[model samples]
Target chain A: MHPPRDGRGPADPPAERRVGLILFWLYVLLYGGFMALVLVRPDLLSVRPFGGVNLAIAYGMGLIASAFLLAVVYMVLRSGR
Target chain B: MLHETSATAVAIFAAFVLGVLWLSFFLGRKGQSASGYYAAHGQIHWFVNGIAFAGDYLSAASFLGICGMIAFTGYDGFLYSIGFLAGWIVALFVIAEPIKALGKFTFADALDARFQSRGIKLAVAISTLVVSIFYLIPQMVGAGSLIKPLLGLPHEVGVILVGVTVTLIVVTAGMVSTTWVQFIKGSLLVFFCGVLTILILGRGLAENTGSLAPQTLTVRPDGTRLVDGKPQERGHDLRPVGTIRALPERYGSRRETGALGPLAYLATLEDSRIVTWAAKKRVDAEGTHTVFTPTERSGADLLKPGGSFKGLTTGNLADRLDFASLMLALFCGTASLPHILIRYYTVKDGEAARRSTVVGIAAIGMFYVLTLYLGLGAMTSGALDPTDTNMAAPLLAKTFSNTLFAIISAIAFTTVLGTVSGLIMAGSGAVAHDLVENVLGIPMTDHEKVRCGKIAAVALGIVAMALGILFRNFNVSFLVGWAFNIAASANLPALVMLLFWPRTTKQGIIAAVTVGMVASLAWILLSADTFEKVYGLSREASVVPFSQPGLVTIPLGFFVLMVVSLLTARPAEHRA
Candidate 1:
């Protein structure tokens, strides 16, 4: 489908909107990837990335952290522009 | 047993109610105009609006339900927080700026702004009410559970009290008081949860298994409760459980671990052996008896997925699909919530909306991170009530200090107040602005509109109280998942299509919303969870294949809107 003239769709809208979309998908990948692993292969999340930190814990904390990180990043990008 | 009412708790709770009522009355002075009453005159400071956004968004479901779920089920419950927060991405990227630019009072205002179609208003308004009611049920339920332990009141009384209080707030001051209420509750909730987590880290982990006692609670139909075949006397209730029954070999013979860092705390929990309760309720000859049995689980096991979402582990294909569907709904539902959407109009411009959303994301994200600690803390704190999972967080606070318990419980009650007020505000807006005024063409003065809204708030408040009392037994988070599914299905499709698709017609929006809302609602009622839980029937006999309706109904909404919009496409009407 083609992009409508409304601001909802643009390959590169502005710096901040672009950053929001990019970070949105990035955060989604981290979250969705973790969820996909849980659905498709439950055992994979059991692997310990390091001592005391398993893939599941890492992925879950990563999702929460990534959200905050992305939001701050968007603010910085918006202010810088 | 989660009941141990302190005079301190009662006094604090009373003070919170008085303060909130006072604020509402004070703000009521400025809310005489339609703009001031509904949209706060579009003058809320961006920072305060941002925190109010956090307060409004983090309902009882977030603070209580997610924490309780994680405390009970482990890592899987945190997924709700992730899905919930991630949905804000859609808001930030697409909906935030545009929504602020479009709507004046409610979510329907944005949808019908361009079309000027009564069909759009009618359909979206009805969707708003449906989603609001679904959302309100869990908040009201959370309120009911909270007061039972703190105030020693019955569950229905708590629900009624909250409904009456919230209705007063909304009817008196509208969004101004609601915004301030949410802002205060939101800040206090995050602050106290942080303090509680710090206390958990300071206290460290210990093997406290000597107090594990399996208890049975029986509740008669007439509201009499019995513990272990004896009536629960005043001020003495059932024991709050959830302790580390045994330790894993890795932490052998180490009764306590010293203060650990954030990562170390989770790491220590992973290799530990914790005892979680498995409850079975049987309604039989005399009364309904729920037996609480202590089951031990390895930390590694608890730290894994599949505890709450059965589809992740040993379930069949349909079960796994149900898990994915619920997650999909949560991810989409955040942007679609009527209460969350209307907050945008409370701000001034698109930039303020964008900034407020970012602030909200940061604040909400930080609180969710604390939830992992709080849930884990409650799981190990030996303060869990096996019968009521909603009490995990507040009861966990009780483990630290009676003062903390009072503060947390009061703040949690305020959490319910803020959220219910927001939901009632959105519903009243739909009733007065969209349905009565727009669809019926009952032209009224601004004062009459505000009066109509107050009446609607009282009526909806009564409905909320009734449902909250009816669904007192449900997990607030689980009930919230249903609301998310409905909102995502009913509202998201029309919204995304309207924003992106040029050929979308007013009729298509109406058909899509009506079909999406009804189909998803029907699917949920016919789903396995409803069959077993609501209808008291066999899950095997349920008609629907999956428990969650989002995977099917959400896609169906978009497809219906696309097909109808294409068939009914008209040129040069709404070109962008």
Candidate 2:
């Protein structure tokens, strides 16, 4: 990850930065939750969440869809600011 | 096993290639200056570059390799897709804007902007070449794999064909042509894959044709095939095999699920019984013959994680660590890739870079979701060539129709060309821009600089072709893991420390990059996978304890940087 050495871009309020960081970590956690399931209990992933879809497949698809969702949200937040 | 060469597939492949080359030549005139050659004059719109980002990032590994892995193994392949897309989060949050703001032409420019040190330039340039070359290997290999069935040529010829073609593309226009090529190919790949997934959902899953007979393939001492213990004549290929033996039995007459929705498809397959291929090679005094045996399995078991990576199951400590190490590398590697990072420089500003990244994540994420269907469709398609899992997707396309197969293969080929061009661009920039201009203190005009970059591109293409031919047997995704590991190990620590740590010195960045690159490279060269697969040696003789080194080398890079920086930091009173 490229670390910004000094701020040279659009400045954001402290509150916005805090919210962005929180949301970023929350997304990471959402991903981490699936991975943790894979590590600790992958069998749980095979368990069906609904009629035909299992937990692993559902959560995996969710993780993919949510990446797009979160990216749109982040962009919206940035532009809104 | 698919040896039939369709005339239509060849015609389509040629036309698509000629069209791409024509476009490259047309755009090549625009980027004559140094900035234009290197960064597309920073004139690319965020949307176009964003889609190009998808094109550049979605190499053969993502499209062909991941699909093949899922087609053969199952959910394990999707793990690579997830890890890859997730890396953009780090890119979006940490790297995107700064990369655009700090750098002029190449990845080295951004890293060396804050430090005018020649040491940093030399270190970063070498690391960029290493990462780019590593990434190029799998793309070239994927190219070779596609050519075998579509063009009916040897794998080496396919490598040479693509190497020459991409070098021509890069020599013509540099980044401008590369960007447009990527933009076009990226759009086509996603669009066609969406079409193919729809076709799969429409066709639905079905039972294997007629009887569930297990086909046995035996090679005689003379290399002739024996099917079911009968010696068949040479040049006759075996039939494609893989099928669903027993269905859910709820259907009236025909024992197949007619049409399945995306979700229902997986569920129905999980509840049914399927026959998958398993091969065992036996050695005699004359030669070695592989027997393609069928193993009856429940679809539920096949849909789980243990098929490809034994780590998720069987409870082996080393395997588990290997899996985790690979996932970590993928997560961290995306932002660190030199080619991926340089795309940000093609945009106008920091905010454009950020916007482009979000667009990329959307495009990439959507395509990855489609991969699940594509791969699963290929899995039960009964068109699988049991010998080469890499051929799964294209072969699945052929099962539908020859015309679709040709189109998909052509798009897959373009995928390789686009990715390889980006890699060559990054490598050439490292050599010409950073290594020569900055590190060696060479003086040259903008025109001469572009010339130097073009020459470097040719040399890098030659190297890629050779490596591609050497690593033909390995899957593209597995080869990509090595690239990701090296990138994450070498670049991530230094980039992160330079931004966050006030005590970080030029010596520290140089040290971290060198140590990380060498350590990871050494680990890979000595690892069991390399010993067994690359070197044709016994795994017991391998030096490294595990195959993956990210779990060790990534943190090791940080530790080395910290220690070296502390030792070399200038006195506070003397600091700027």
> How do the residues B1-576 of candidate 1 rate in per-residue lDDT, one tens digit apiece?
647689999999999999999999998998889998899999998889989988998999998999899989898888888888888888887788767876889999888766788999999999999999999999999999999999999899999999999999999989999999999988988888899999999888888866567788998888788988889775556777778766556677788887878888888888788988888889987889998888889998998988888767885799899989999999899999999999998888877887899888888888988988999999998888888899999999988888889999999999999999999999999999999999999999999999999999999999999999999989999999999999999999998787667687788899889999999999999998999989999999999999899999999999999889878876554444
Q: How do all models score by TM-score?
A: 0.95, 0.95
lDDT of each: 0.88, 0.86
Name the docking class for model 1: acceptable
Separate DockQ for every predicted complex: 0.44, 0.46
Residue B189 Cα positional deviation in candidate 2, in Å, after optimal superposition: 0.4
Backbone collision count in every prediction? 3, 0
Two-chain complex of model 2, DockQ on C-alpha atoms against the true structure: 0.46
lDDT of model 2 at residue B351?
Answer: 74
Candidate 2 lDDT over B1-576, as tens digits, reads: 647788999999999999999999999999899999999999999999999999999999999999889887777888888899988887887677766777888887877777778898898899999999999999999999999999999899999999999999999999999999999999999999999998998988887754455566676777666766666544545667667777776754677677788878888888888877777777777456677777788888887778888878987888888888888888889999999999998989877887898889988998999888888888888888877777888888888899999999999999999999999999999999999998889999999999999999999999999999999989899999999999999999988777557678788899999999999999999999999889978888998888989999999999999999989877881374
Interface RMSD for candidates 1 onward, in order:
4.0, 3.3
Global lDDT of model 2:
0.86
List ranges where model 1 is wrong by over 4 Å. A1-19, B211-213, B220-224, B234-237, B248-252, B571-576
Query: Per-residue alpha-carbon lDDT of model 2 for A1-81, expressed as tens digits?
Result: 223345442234445545456667877899889878888898898898777878877887888788788778888887887
